[model samples]
Target chain A: MNDAQAPIVPAVEVLAFDIFGTVVDWHGSIVRELGRRYPQVDGDAFALAWRAGYKPAMVRVMSGELGWTLIDDLHRMILDAILPQFGLERLGEEERRELNRVWHRLDPWPDAVAGLQRLKRKYLLCTLSNGNLGLLTRMAKRAGLPWDCVLSAEVFRAYKPDPATYLGVARVFDVPPDRVMLVAAHHDDLAAARACGLRTAYVVRPLEFGPAHPKDVAPQAGNDLHSRDLLHLADLLDC
Target chain B: MNDAQAPIVPAVEVLAFDIFGTVVDWHGSIVRELGRRYPQVDGDAFALAWRAGYKPAMVRVMSGELGWTLIDDLHRMILDAILPQFGLERLGEEERRELNRVWHRLDPWPDAVAGLQRLKRKYLLCTLSNGNLGLLTRMAKRAGLPWDCVLSAEVFRAYKPDPATYLGVARVFDVPPDRVMLVAAHHDDLAAARACGLRTAYVVRPLEFGPAHPKDVAPQAGNDLHSRDLLHLADLLDC
Candidate 1:
């Protein structure tokens, strides 16, 4: 679905990536963490169930059906509901809270660190995630994700696919919309970015959802560039 | 006023530095940038004149006489006034805007980067600058500042010396006031931080205002730690 032959416009100055699946191995990390913490629990099922609650919880905040809430808060809300579903009734409040923060300690894909380091040497690289500043900052520190800055939907008080979040990065840098690029594994995010006159790069993360679930295997891209991973993206950009 | 025998408390978990002269050599940077742009202009005098307007502009914002403005805006205001004062009227509006952002491209002190890197391995290091997030983020990228996160008074909509600004960093990291240390070269800034239940580190920047302006040489011990530079502070902390 990509237009490889289309004339590529060279406009983007900052390349912002979606954090969860685009940069890190969220499902793998969550399952690994769950297995380590609760050996008897169905780690794979728990990971999938935990992630299932994410989109709905964010919808609550995005629709203003709930007050402005951070991703950390959203994660905690989802964690509380899933705890009983997994039959983990004995987990104390402190343990539950710490476990919810496993999102903050999510492991980076092997290429993520080296690719980002290389990209950072040239362009301004940051996380334009739906995550909150506190969550993003802690994640970067814990996982050694060297972000130039962490720009988020929390900064704009709106979630992704929202034009405000896409344009806010450009506005913060005092650059034109076309001078910013959204690099994500999801086509919807790229479409939203393209709608805002920003460039887009599609990164394929086949295992983002784990072995039980399949990501879109086809090279479906509405973006300016499609690459295998961050390193390939960096190479494509000649960085 | 030096207290060599005072019982020392444990070092703070986060050491947030005031950036203007604490982390970066602002005077040197501004003077060099001004000299590069206008060879005929007396860069030293021009820098001093530009800096002189800073406090008054901040006062207007602080007094609520003016709406809350970012330091980037305040810097531009000073730049506009001082550009004519220095008799350099050749710069266009775009040039002036870009030049005003030399604040965001200021060079870090020789010890600043190394010290920050060392401290980051042990404690969370952030900028509690009066400069806005955009300015701070750009500066960090340009100067290779390894801040785990960058916190600014702009985040709190309050300028430094305001208790809210000092306390904001602690609140952001979910840490107590006592666990956050304000590291600055300015005595007034350190005093304000100490008043707000934060520990303080005094790093002397003798040439911060050039040879004409002298820094406080005597160790007043008003702060918890007094060091010659960031490296010395790192040594004291055993980082």
Candidate 2:
């Protein structure tokens, strides 16, 4: 192995998992949920646009153009904006409100629960998600994610890729950044975590965008560990 | 029943618990942990002085005499001031720091885990404590206290009996005050909760102050439900 990719390993105490695409199959859940309500509209496109709106919406908050808004509200804002474009604006306020809660009931990837159970035995497990506290809490209840603590952008009033969201996990547990490793699917997420001095574990979620879009399977530069899934990462960590 | 004694139970969806004396035996844990390190000192009296400093320290933050300080830091402040009084200032800084974490490992009341588990079946359970997020998270892990989310005064930057703490739980879930219940042992805590329109459940912890002080077991004026312990409250809630 080259010196640049020597794999920086440390005695990790806390494993903060990025929840949405990393643990739960958000695309699958959103597509399925949107399909149920809007049969006339293309569910895949609807789900894609809804999620695509997320980062830009959060950027408004990060840039201080907007106040600290919960991801639930952000999801709703995106949903409201796109529904009329997709010819699904007939949905009432209450229906749209209920549909936005699909984020709260996203199904966990099959291996997530067992892998978390294994990793949890060895290290403290927490959700360091962009999802708000209410969304994360309801998701934990629905999917039984077994998080020791459900932390969110809501807690720090900042979204992911922000330094506060990554470092906030360490601050919550009073642990150093090095001891708090962020296990995530996306290279950008891990990159942000690494920049914040946290160790990074990259798990490939090929089905993150559903069976058709098998993206981000290969390892990127600077990840401490790269594996096929959360279970594979757990095995790599000797959990 | 008179108007003052009337029951005001609304259909509740969430139950927020007070941890220190209500859910966990802080005095017992503090006395035991202190006794191990400082056998020469009166552990009971030391524990009392340390706890007695808690509200005053929190008051400093609330009154803006001090800025937003976590209970962990507040506890350390009290510990440092009283250590010389108890003649245990000889303990090194590292040892003192580790000992301060005893608050993080306090033993839950015998019925807390089971009762919380029972309550979890029916209602969303959370911790609404003066303790910091880190302290509460560690205590939950050690004691197997199953909280849907562990919240604290640190979250709102305000301590208990403050309207912010009680109303904060409702805000987290986006529920009305009547749909959220405050499960605490102290009447002052419940009274504050009631004034904010939250339903109140009183759980009596008989040995909260140890055997010599069997205190505050009687039902108060405004509690919606009063019970012998958390198990009894779970029974009362039909969870």
Q: Judged by TM-score, which candidate is best? A: 2
Which digits, one per residue and each the tens of the lDDT, describe model 2 over residues B18-74?
999999999899888877877888888888889889888888899998988889999
The whole-model lDDT of each prediction reads 0.85, 0.87
Model 1 docking tier (incorrect/acceptable/medium/high): medium
DockQ for model 2 equals 0.78
Q: In candidate 2, which residue pairs clash?
A: none
Deviating ranges (above 4 Å) for candidate 1 = A1-9, B1-11, B220-222
- Minimum summed lDDT over a 10-residue window in model 1 chain B is located at B1-10
- For model 2 the local lDDT of residue A143 reads 92
Off by over 4 Å in 2: A1-8, B1-10
TM-score, cand. 2 vs. native: 0.96
Least well predicted 10-residue stretch by lDDT in candidate 2 chain A: A1-10
On residues B16-118, what C-alpha lDDT tens digit does candidate 1 reach at each position?
A: 9899989998899988997888888888898888888888998999999999888888888888877776786778988988898899999999999998988
